[model samples]
Target: MARNKYDVDEVLEDKFDVNQLKRLLAYLIPYRKRFVSVGFMMLSASAFTMLIPQFFQKVMDVCIPNKDMKGIAFYSFLTLLAAFYSAFSLRYKIKYTNQIGQQIIHDMRYDIFEHLQELPFSYYDDRPHGKIQVRVVNYVNSISDLLSNGILNTITDLCNLVFIIVFMLILNVRLTLVCLCGLPILAIVIVVIKKKQRTAWQVQSNKQSNLNAYIAESINGIRVTQSFVREDVNSGIFNNLSGSYRKSWMRAVMFNFTMGPSIDIISIITTAAIYVLGVSWMINGETGITVGVLVAFTAYIGRFWAPINTLAGFYNSLLTAISYLERIFETIDEPVVVKDREDAVEMPPIHGDVAFDHVTFSYEPGVPILKDVSFHANQGQSFAVVGPTGAGKTTLVNLLSRFYNVDSGRILIDGIDIAGVTIRSLRKQMGVMMQDSFIFSGTIMDNIRYGNFSATDEEVIRAAKTVCAHDFIMEMENGYQTQVNERGSRLSAGQRQLISFARALLADPKILILDEATSSIDTETEIILQKGLNELLKGRTSFIIAHRLSTIKNSSCIMYVDKGTILEKGTHDELMAQKGEYYKLYMSQYASLM
Candidate 1:
């Protein structure tokens, strides 16, 4: 397996780009109605909240000073109405924002899932399973928070700030102007901290993803680690990744933790200045501002700073959320390399005549895996490929199914170029059994039915019988209803192979490809599978990548592959008589079996 190469610094730097954040926010456009409702509720709350100080001014200036009990009662009732409105507005804002947030999360998760489905096989090969999983889960969740709470709260806070400032100025311009002197400084500080924290948090998030990928790889390959006795080495690597994550987190936290308190300290100093100046002016009879008005101004000053401080605290979360959005957007933006061509047509059902017309392929440019590998299998013919490991035998099967497109030349199914055919239509006519069989976590019946979802119970049983797997399946405790544990851990390798054979048999495809299907089985089971396979191969164009020499001895033709090309091609008897590459390979393998 190739080692993963991921750089935390590169991923982090990419996260801070403004374009990435803007694109992520664009997902919220479809939920504009909910956002509008939430905005209205926020505005209403701010309006009512701003009225409270004016109500206090009213009670002091007109009601209490006049000694008019009726006037005081009326003013108090109006204050109560404002409080009710504020409470009602808050309720609506909470309900709408939360609904909008959850809906955006749902849509984003679905979009990521759909994109993953459309991505090519090469994408998976180049990326780690754990990394992809972390991107899907962590990145999407972060984006959800960004859309729901971060953006919504930022908008509300800004609205509240505007309303508070306007009302404060209306009450006493001198006091408001004095308090506003600190606003520019606070804004500058927030901008600086936001920039620093964005970079730090992006680094932290990348480290987290890298760490998650490492952990996933370690856990999935624990068996290999244990067998190799390299647990301590693996632990050291994990510790190093986790340490990097921790250091990055602390760096981000250092900047973020200072923002809220720093803003509050500035607000406090501004408030103290206002109190001292107002008191001196009143004592000197230098202004018309009353003590009550000064006190209300102080309250409004606090309200002004409150939103700023809250927004400052939200900076860290915003950066983290944006980092997640960047990761998700990266995945969504990955080009689909194997998509159907615009004019691609649905392939007709196969009569099993497959032709490889100078088919050359390479996953990477300038490094070909199959070099001009041309061959043909007529209807009802069994062709065998004999090659050493890494001789591109399995690559041949992969090309036939269009798992990876060829770099040069073309493959034809019954004279129709595969490149012009819809992938679904092309794959539907084939049945493939890999060297390592995979049984999903489900009942035996379900596993077999996976080959043909619409297969009846009778059809499933018949398929199993055809593959000689029915007897063993019936002997199990729950028979066909038996549950296979994860990856069929509960079953022996041979049993899993038998079940896999049944699955392919159920599909009854015209074209069949078996890549070392019976190699893992015991001798007795292999013999049994051989009998079933002979019957299955009667009327299909089968390509077998055989490990056991006996299996390919009766094939219609045997192609000896070497260094990505066929060195020799002939029937088993003809090749044996030639005493060439095929003869040497067969004799060596036969000697091992003996």
Candidate 2:
């Protein structure tokens, strides 16, 4: 599979449908009441802001000229009231907007996470861990600013512009026309800058995502890098990534920085023209042209151009935001392809009988991983699968877990077709111990309890003792309260495997699977694990996949797999006596073990 790049630059140049954003906004439909309240508060704030200039006009023209104390007091009080209303309206809008933003993030994050969980194993196989991490954290965070401040500010700015334009026209239509003359040129400049800014911003975003992915991959592989002494080489690569990110960021900044000054120059030229025209009208003794009106008109001109400038800037931000919104929506909109069918029934308690009838599967079309595979294990039977690497041993266990459905054929448990059963119930009866045992950052006791969250302390201890993990766990600095660190980094690989074994044992599953479960352990630990395994597999149907033949030499049936086909099946002794593929593989490993 090809690697995916989070390069924002490339993503930004690609066209995105506006319909996706419309659909994303539909998630806020249930919060319309809050939206309405926020809108009202924003409008109220704008109205009060527009009223402030009118009051200044009154104080200058009417109150000062009349020297009327009562009128001055009343207008001053009205100004104070308007200020309070503006402050209150701002407070309400800010509070509500934050709530709306957080709610949207909460919903979007959950939707993305749940969708990820529902995606098939094949989907994960094709996707990198770093890319998924970027989607969950960085991509989700970017949208919060868009939903909260960006949306609210865009709406408020539009309303303010409309009100200011109408009020200015009402004051003097001729002067309003002069002030508005620069708008068309301003609008054209804004459109050009916005397009360039969007492209640049996209590039920057992509670079940042790539850098993040690189960092995540490097950190996770620190042990390998150290062992190979590739620190200098890795640093050089990191420097290259950082350099590319910085260059992209500089390009975006250049475009954004040009916008404010270009708009300001236009505003300056228009203001000069307005001054010349307004002074000429005054000299000609145009009726109703007061000094106060001229001053207020200039103030309105300032207000007009400021928003025009802000609108230009906002246009660029909106494009960046839209890009982010598209990425976030893409993840949430991914289809849940592994959902249960409407007619699928909840599975009953299992009897440990598992059968695969002529099963066939492939991760990709026309490339079979398991072909015409048939197997049966009666209740309490121990079945072992031995194979060369890439012989579909682990794939068989994945099929039994229904992580991937068969391309052709069916699996049955307790005489019921697994396809007809709900996945949740079907998986509930199985316990798995994989080669790379995952231990979360928590106490040993807490990790064991993860297998069955409802298990009591006594049950947890019993399970630990069954896996011979209790003694080592108790010797830890804080016993059951000891922190494991991320991925159990503080523990040896063998110790981590023991904890995972205890966890699986605690679950008390009817069927058990061990995939190279003791491959990392020393001889002494493997012997202890083997004894515990004997006890654990006594009454449960078990499927063990092992590269080490000694581990499964006593199983009820041993199957040798080669190139996605079952080459032989019989008791271990019988396979040795046959002197075929199994015999050759066992003899090769037996000679090496000596």
Which number leads on TM-score? 2
* Model 1 alpha-carbon drift over 4 Å, by segment: 1-17, 286-288, 592-594
1-594, model 1: which lDDT tens digit per residue?
A: 233444333342243478876776777899888788778877777787787777777778777888888977887887788888888877887777778888888887888889999887788887667777877787777666667777877888998898888888887888888998998887787777777777777788778878888888888688799999999998899889999999998998898787777777888899899999999987888655886688678879889988887777566677667767777777887778787899999999889888999989888889998999888889999999988999999998988998888988989889999999999898888999998789999999999989799999999998888877899999999999998887788898888988898888888899999988888778787777788889999899999998787888889999999789999999999999999999999888787666
Whose lDDT is greatest here? 1
Tens digits of per-residue lDDT for model 2, 68-141: 87888987898898888888988888888888988888888888898888877776775556667777888778
List lDDT for all candidates, in order.
0.83, 0.82
- What would you estimate as the lDDT of candidate 1? 0.83
- Angstrom error of the Cα, residue 304, model 2: value is 2.4
Which residue pairs in model 1 clash with each other? none
- When summed lDDT is taken over every stretch of 10 residues in candidate 2, the lowest stretch is 5-14
Per-prediction TM-score to the true structure, in the order listed: 0.93, 0.94
